[model samples]
Target: MSALERLNGTRLTGTEEAFALHRRINRTATDYPRDSSVPALFAASAARHPDALAVVQDGRAYTYARLDRLSNGLARRMLAQGFTPGSTAGVCLTRSPELIVALLAVLKCGGVYVPFDAGWPDERLRGLLARADCRWVLTDRPEQLARRLGACRVLPVDEGVEECETAPGVEVGGDALAYVNFTSGSTGSPKGVAIRHRSIARLVLGARFARLEADSRLLQLAPVTFDAATFEIWGALLNGGTCVLYPEGLVRLSRLGRVIDDHRVTVVFLTTALFNAVIDEAPGALDGTETVLMGGELHSIPHVAAALRRYGPGRLVHVYGPTEATTFATYHRIDRLIPDSGLLPIGTPIQNTRLYVTDGTTLCEPGRTGEICLAGDGLSPGYLGMPELTAERFVDREIDGVGERLYRTGDHGTLLPDGSLVFQGREDDQVKINGFRIELGEVAHHLDRHPAVRRSHVTVSTERGERSLVAFVVADPSVTSASLRHHLRTLLPAYLVPARIHLCEALPLTATGKVDGRALLAAHDTHTPPPAAPAAQPVATRD
Candidate 1:
């Protein structure tokens, strides 16, 4: 039998054993039972650590006690308004402590917080509000938001909130909706993904619940519009961990790590691109900080190795999951990622999360490739208001007469010999070029594995009647587009090779920080002159 066949569930592979050892990342030993309610966890944490700081920004910090009050007042204010059970309240705020408080309040008011982006183009934002049928928006001033939203109601969250109703509102429970997150659609219109509170609780509460001390500071770098922001907000406040916020802007977050250190910040999560920036700009200055969770996109292992050599291991925690499955449902505790290990494993599924790789109808055995199916409390109800879309993505099957809904992660992977999953990106990412179906992630994987390419996005662009393969890459100072493409040709078939390679300063990212393939395609121009031949030195870190 191959080494991968010897494993069941999550056993270590021979290949993995050849590399560095993984630490105690899986929380199964902790015996922490997954809870069913999201609000109760927050309430319990607040009660247990009321005086602990829950959020911070530009010298501003909010304690759990304060967070409770703010959210309660806001909830009551929302209740005072006509926000009945299931009432859709939109929040168009940036990432901040108040944003969390506002979202929680909307939740407490027996309504769902449909997160809208204040930074979205007016047309996009308007389209989202209209599609969501958003009755009102919680803002500093609803009047302005109201004008843009048409007849929809606007409830100001910052200023004075209306009083709570004398009578209790709807009693929302596990299955009730929590929030709606919109993903950019291919057709230019965004698709709304509805998430239930059960999924939210599972991802946040199931993990080992460490007490967030009075001083544990977590920086809020993601925007509230993105689903991962939910983790930074809830993950901290629900643990009594202080979540520090950065004002919404185009500034690179790595630039502010020093300021975070100056404040004795303890923890912060970053998308891979942002994490690499900190590594390039200032590496060691981040040693004193606590956990640095990274996921959302592919992070280079060699780059991580260099960081480990410069700073230390155990500083970076690689997490993975789609917004469809809460912020992050899987994690790989990495001390170091060695090249001989092959593709990076997403590590193990978190607490209550159970992952399986199946070929549509049949669950594949170990070492076999299949689509990733996630079964757990973390799975969202599915796409919002898109029943056909929701039903299509969420597959319900009867296992021994018990029916359970499983999420098709759209990703494909092979069960590792070690029982950990090695991600292969979206199955749809696999496209037929020259009669052969190739996983874009596979080509991108080879690129990431390349010593010279720091990070890359592989895509197919249409030219006349042909689909031309292209790769937009951010690379080490030593690499070039020609060199990178040449490296790929050695491993992949000629037709699969990215004929046109563009050495980018950085990969474009969506608001949620995932690599924006469409955005790059839109911005790309094959006719443009090569960038004035950049010097063979460290270019300033790209955002």
Candidate 2:
């Protein structure tokens, strides 16, 4: 029998045993200040470097002392208004220095901040805030949003609030809920992942993956709602670095390059899709950036090689983790060209983090494919208001006679003998488009709600190295793909909206009577041409 087959049945050799141990748990026992909250850490940094640049945007800059006083004023105001520890507040504002102030203020007041993208539809934002049990919303357009969300009180942070610049007296612990990040769910509802202050500290403080120091200038390009902001924002503030906010709205590649050049940005994190675009369109954008980290989807080998060739090795990093793991868990620095496998290793776990590859009950041996599981200080407590699901996903498993709780990432990967992990793809219908996590079931659930539609299936289609959502629907004869697309755009976010909707008489099925997604795509490829527009109509047939 092979070494892998005998791994579970008998004792292994020393090298095999070492590989087994490595596959079961790859971790670094790094210590961090576990008793302090995120706000407390920021406060400490402010005290140490009072005059250091803390945040900047379009020629506007705030020193550490100034930002601290601003947040202190807001926090004092919030406390006087009955906001207390454990209170949930929604922050809906455009990307600016004010948004950072609001986030820090909420944490200072010991409230959980639920970030809402201002670009999101009002209806969608209202539903999410209600689901999160938010009693107040801090926004730039408070009056307008307050009218729509009548149930929650709204406070304006953009125009600035006049209050005392004294810090609040409240003391928050490390285990306190810091923020709630919502991700796409299969049940047609977005689930909020509740992360704690300690989790954030574990990710940013003493992070070995990227360079973060007082002299570091990190670019804040990600949306506040995305968990990546946790790294970009706190990774700077908590480290006495400067967070240069990118201008709001669509990220133009030319403008992005200019911003990085002007700010002398030392660290940057980009989604795989955007990174690929930068490499293809503007390779010079990263010329000045000291460290460029990219992930959120499987990377292209050619793009990786191109970036390495331009930036040289040791500067470009490939990171992997889910929102549930606080931002990043494993990071691989590409010091050389990728091997013939063309698959980039996700690398090993970061400091104070643990990673495992397992097949439900037992840990997988090296070279065996299994689910990627994560544990350690970076793991979030659980999903907000999803006890059952929290229990299902986060479970206690005995590893090497030690009971530990691990988040079972549905992503499939294989553990290498050297303890690095290589991405193989996900085991579920979720897909990451432009770095946004999307659930195919959630899209289909909303599509099936359309009155004219009988049934629908949503799948991702890749053409020319780009991934887009495609919906196949069996609908009324009078219904056009345009109307269906419009209907979906109203309910879902822009990214969740399918790029192409194909109207059909029936959906293709497998012999076992399930929706044959492969058959549908195969037939569509045979019958339909490349989609030039946002919608398509094809005469689909059952297999």
Candidate 3:
């Protein structure tokens, strides 16, 4: 039996059942035979394709030679300024070629790059920088950030634009710290996830999920501060592919369609919500792309069913992972139509990764739901500067014969009959309405099945001391709340049906483009409840 088969608890046997099982739970881990540092590997790519196009932004292009020289100059300057190994530096800049240069330069100088969003408030930025203890900050506009970051050295990327000697090489180990990214915490204070060079090298170098190559042209669609950008930028740079960066604001479907076609982008990644919007508004937006990787929320596969059926050029892949898992832990390729259930499984673990669905003590059996846990080289070191919080989320567990560290994803999922995983909602998303438990994801799944309904978001709220469920839906202008409630009644129980429904032209989105449930709940609170239709009247209840 192969090591992979042993890892997955499959025994080798001369039988068709074992053959089918081997094909069912199979993923090939990529082997890294060269530099583990992302920057060093990118430099090697530049050596091979110096004159190739490396990045294109706003009608301007940058070649691999230019990018290499610019980042090398900046890294030399940073090294002269005492930014050395084990030092953390903040990168605060707008989305452009300079942002890419700044990030690569930080990595090249052996400094941890803590990327800051230019659109964030000054207070939040200040707090995050302080928490990270960044030694210096790199940006295009030092004047703008100087006041907010008192005493921290603010270095401008434009300085020393001419090529200088490359920074002296440092012996960087795989375990050396690389970058720190802050997650949007539920407690209002973001937690910084500290990752290492090994984790990043495993994710970027020859990753199969991305399908990036020397000739691949990948569009950088996510914000620079988001973790998805890590895959977009390095996946291209490490493989000698071209990184096509989009403009600064949210990209609409029309603009996305134009950009992909104009640039002949071979690969791109989008949030699940954005992917659904494109399928609903412009089904042919990704007609020419070779691959599309999307995740971050429950996928609306029914909307994408037609594209798969037509055998379009693009291969739609659903990638699932949390911030702690280095952006991609599991992936599922949608090559066929989804079953009638309108649900897609969050497939097996990626290269060098192992997953466990546990009920906090024992492993879950097939078709049983449990908390999703992940362990592998891609796991982050821990939450930066927050040991207690880190210990709570990243814990140790005994799996198979050895004890390994795993990150509790706080996501509920189940193993399918064929060894795939089906995502249930977040642990907190399981709500109790009038003493009846309901999975919000299941309710949304049924609601999306309606022909006129494009998307649905459900949230529980209390008004006048009476708690009930409120559903916000994106549907045709003429679609009524009564029709939705009646449609849902046929699929869900009476208690599971939302007590109130609101139709909107488009669902509101968070900064990261996920459905904003809190915003919808607040919007529903101010409006008076609508009268129920005669055929969809609610059962009598006591408050």
Better of 2 and 3 by lDDT: 2
Pick by lDDT: which candidate is best?
2
Residues 383-408 of candidate 2: C-alpha lDDT, one tens digit per residue: 87889999889977655645567898
Worst 10 residues of 1 by lDDT: 531-540
Which residue pairs collide, candidate 1?
Answer: 4-417, 11-418, 12-418, 13-418, 135-153, 136-153, 266-290
> Which of 1 and 3 is the better model by lDDT?
3
lDDT at position 197, candidate 2: 95
Local lDDT at 503 for model 2: 82
Clashing pairs in 3: none
Q: Return the TM-score for each candidate structure.
A: 0.72, 0.92, 0.75
Model 2: how far residue 515 lies from native, Å: 2.4
lDDT of 3: 0.74
User: Which candidate number has the best TM-score?
Assistant: 2
User: Candidate 2 — which residues are off by over 4 angstroms?
Assistant: 1-20, 23-25, 525-543
